[model samples]
Target: MRKNVGFHSVRSFSDRRWLLPFLASLLVSFTLFMATIFGLFSSQNVGDSLSLDIVSFTTLDDFENDSIGTDRKKLLDQPAIMQEEAPRIAYLITGTKGDSQRMRRTLQAIYHPRNQYILHLDLEAPPRERIDLTMYVKGDPLFSQVENVRVIAKANLVTYKGPTMIACTLHAISILLKESLRWDWFINLSASDYPLMTQDDILHGLSSLPRNLNFIEHSPISGWKLTQRARPIIVDPGLYLSKKFEVFTTTERRELPTSFKLYTGSAWVMLTRSFLEYCIWGWENLPRILLMYYANFISSPEGYFHTVICNSNEFKNTSISHDLHYISWGYPPKQHPLYLSTKDFNRMVKSGMPFARKFAKGDPVLDKIDRELLGRANGQFTPGGWCNQTSSDEMAEQCSSRGDDSKFLPGPGAERLQQLMKKLMSQEFRNGSCSSLQYDQTKRDWITPKKPA
Candidate 1:
């Protein structure tokens, strides 16, 4: 039996309960009373733990309506004066050559003074292009003043559709973690991706969540994927050669890992800081073990993090198994999802996903998103409550001046995102974790075993 913590019980004033539970409640009350008489609040203070991050299983509306945790209760009871203590996201936006301008535009659209951004143009981009990106970041008045936006000076040779993608991601992650290390989560995006919600909506929605939960969409390999993906052995030349080359497959095949089950998913992810630390610099051996194993795995980006997370018993239960990106797979499937277009706008907005990917550059569809979906006035940052500049000058208005970074004015995005999270986090979805399946030659699909409750 699990030992119940005595500190959690609330005093029952009007309820009739069993003697055991009643006595437990009385005991908890007495304990707190005694603690108050003395100085025993230290138990709750783990490390600079003054902030009440206990709104999990609760929403911002709930925070307003009810008397919640002691500190949150007190805060809610106060007048609606916003305090500046919101969490910040560290973004690693990577792209290859010919994507510098798109990356720049994406960066500006998502830019906030509070968040850290690391833009990378991989080795496929010529030296001039990389220099141009760095110059762009350095020259921008807002970027220069905030000092949170950075362009990768030393670019990695990222192999298209290879483990190099994950490597480049981790490289940026390591630098950020080592340099500032204050971010709550590390979100990886490519230049092709764009945010569907304002930063205010994104941050406010996440503020109520448990900080440790990782949002990675993943599933077990079955049928076609198991054979077509796992059995193949291919080496990425980006790992050794200066210039990127195609992956070469060996005639040999390998067996699935006995120690850990393999998982696969979308490359886009919003990973928790604690999990990132484990994957990058933890004392544990699992991260390194999986890294070496995936060196020869085709499309390692999909499987690398998935395998490490699902295989570790500790993290499996914690996986929400959703990459949180709005993407549409073509019927019968294709190499990449159908590039999001104007036709997908209504569905995209209703999906409640914070980000969507694979848009054709400067597509008129993007303009529609900017105007209607994101509320970003033409080529401007998403207009949030944080924006305070006068709306006269197009370039120097609204986003030029700022308010408290912590304040939030979440629009429809928050509501949509909350519903999406509810589905991913439901008991049924979580219990149906990454499974082991075998291909049925006749079925021409994965034949999965009956799952146990």
Candidate 2:
């Protein structure tokens, strides 16, 4: 009986010891699983790893929610919202020979954390300059980290005022679409162009508008001009040659194209990614037809996209018929607008246009714009809340360190931009701005069509 009792006690103690360890192990497993589930729902900035130090850029400040706008504040306050209302932009800044520095400056002027930019030094530029451009794009720290900005690796020779301009534009768009998935809009600009509004203003303004609306100036071609432009058989050598060449006119001009009515307008445009996707992706045949049609046309960039958008029944009404660029032309209207100077600065500001074209490189007006309009110091990024590295004591370059990118702090520029948005969206201008433009002298922004001659 003594041995039996001793054996029983030993068995009970051993069983209990094993049971305790098993229970402890179960508790630990459950605790670990709970911690993991909690972490899965927590917030994480998507851009923590992705950085784009587009060459020639100085900094990128973490985006602040309040800094963005009022509407974004509510959405950002919630932890499980899982997304931001603020959208991304992909820009194509194209420049010709000797315009490389201006392209860099325009890029720096419009730089932002939520945007992707593709710079193109067209065939008009020397190979050395193109290499310089690529070096700038690849060497920037912020751009390298973000991995957002990229220069066209395979440069194409472009002819001024020819089909190659359109080709280069399309090529850049294709590359941007393939390389990045975050952009909402595709904007094309030239070296002679510069930004009038801040990124904050433009981004915030776009967030409120429908994503389908395309900002392009367009007009229906008719009568004498239609017959002349439609039938012109011009061949561009830029597509075939390895060196600089001009477009040649065949001694033959054909009759007007009855199949599709010709449309002509400003080449500058802000196109939606969806429309660009339609053009790049072969889901529809309309874009393909227009591409072939404009292959031999003069100034095809000015007409290809215009015709494509207008001809497509699906995309016709989506046109806003405004290029969103401020261009001051000579009294008689020359090929390019007069060089913008101090005399045009106030008018430029009051115009409330986000972008302006034909500014001479190294012009003092550009310096004045950088100082007064952009609030940018020499050789630095435009001041914005994204830059936190600046000292709190005064507005300074503080983006040396970055914080959360989800936040935004918009400024007066945003409000003025909103007014411009309101004017564009008003019912009075809706139809007139779309497919039909009627110029109104009272409002410089209003367009009234000239009678068919």
Candidate 3:
């Protein structure tokens, strides 16, 4: 009788264990059902509040108007966005034979301790000139102290009309990328280029911009020049030759590329570090493919970056459609732009462009610019807020010593640049970015064929 009673007790406990778990599961299900019903009802209430009928008490137009005005006022009251530190620029100044002095002058005019500079005297320059350039860059006290200046040791045989020029530019960019990662933008300039503003003004103006913008004046390659540029098969001997040589054309003509459209633009460019990284690193294959395609293309410098940037979905919208340099061309245009002189100074200034190109080496207009616009005395670096010499009496020795590089005292130049930037960022400018048909039309008009008279 005792054994049977113990067995019955164990069976009863086991049954009760199952009952508890079942009841707990039932409770959880009930809780979830209740929560779902509550959520549904709350959503219905929100929907009702948003309905058109609710606007009877407060007219929809009136509410919208009030909200829009309030939002605008709030946006206006918000603090302006600014960078925590002054932006740094990386400059690649290229030159050929007989450009040593001019390159040095341009370097000093644009030099700032906060920026990095790389000088490339191409293989066309004699060994003595290259040595002299290297010595000058190394001998400068400020450059030695700051260690921001570098010279390309292995000079490239660059052909301006061939892919070699683009290769040289890329080589310099690679060096800059490896040397310092702090610079925000990379600006490419020839020895013929000169700055119209001080580094302080540039930094001040650029501080307000998004860092990813690329300034490259670009349009599609079409019309009269299309057959000339795209159909020819040319070989650039600079790629394999130890000495410079002109590009030679083959007898065979090929069809225009069906894989990708061709684009052309000014060779001069100011590109962002991120976009350059994308080009150099090339996690995507577009940059590499276009590079190979342009290897045989004439004047690759004019088209390589333009084609790459416009074709890239990632970087197309980031293009600003301006080269940021003031250049003058003839009515019908020519292979080379007309050399700028004193006569063009007023127009150059009025244009509000920061840099101008193809200035004759040591032109009097450069002196005028240095005197009036840059305030840089003979053989002195451009004066900036970073220099302690403020008095006119010390003009001769200004920029010899350093002050607070972090501070900037921008003048009229900065205001002009700001105005230009506002215009570039306007709705009109935004609408014109990477327009396929519009670019083709512009190219057609630019190189319109004359009637056979």
Index of the highest-lDDT prediction: 3
Candidate 2 lowest-lDDT run of ten: 49-58
Candidate 2, residues 1-453, lDDT tens digits: the string is 999999999998877777778999999999999997665445233432222233113222322322322333343222222124777788999887898788888888988877888888877678899898888878877678767777886778888767888888888888877765688788999888988877877887777665666888888776755656677888988989978788888889877677777888899999988678878874447789889888988788889888888886556656887888889887888777888988999988888789997888788989888887777777666656666654643443655334445455666667777777777765566665435543233452324356659
* Candidate 2 Cα errors over 4 Å, as ranges: 1-84, 390-396, 433-453
**lDDT (CA) per prediction:** 0.76, 0.75, 0.82
TM-score of each: 0.75, 0.75, 0.77
- Model 1 lDDT tens row, 1-453: 123433233434334458779899999999999987554356355533333444333444452343343354343233323324577799998888799989987887777777899998998889999898899788877677668988888888899767888899889999988896568878898899988887877888777565656778788876887788888888889989888789888899999888878888878788877678779974457899999988888888898988888876445545677888889997988887898898998889989999998899888888887776567766467766677755534422567566766667788888887787667655556555552332232442323456679
Q: After superposition, how far is residue 227 of candidate 2 from its true place, in Å?
A: 4.3
Candidate 1 residues lying further than 4 Å off, grouped into runs, are 1-85, 390-396, 434-453
Q: Tens-digit lDDT track for model 3 on 20-49? A: 889999999999999988876886788855
Error of 2 at 285 (Å): 1.2
RMSD, candidate 2, Å: 15.1
Which has the better lDDT: candidate 2, or candidate 3? 3
Model 2 scores a C-alpha lDDT of 0.75
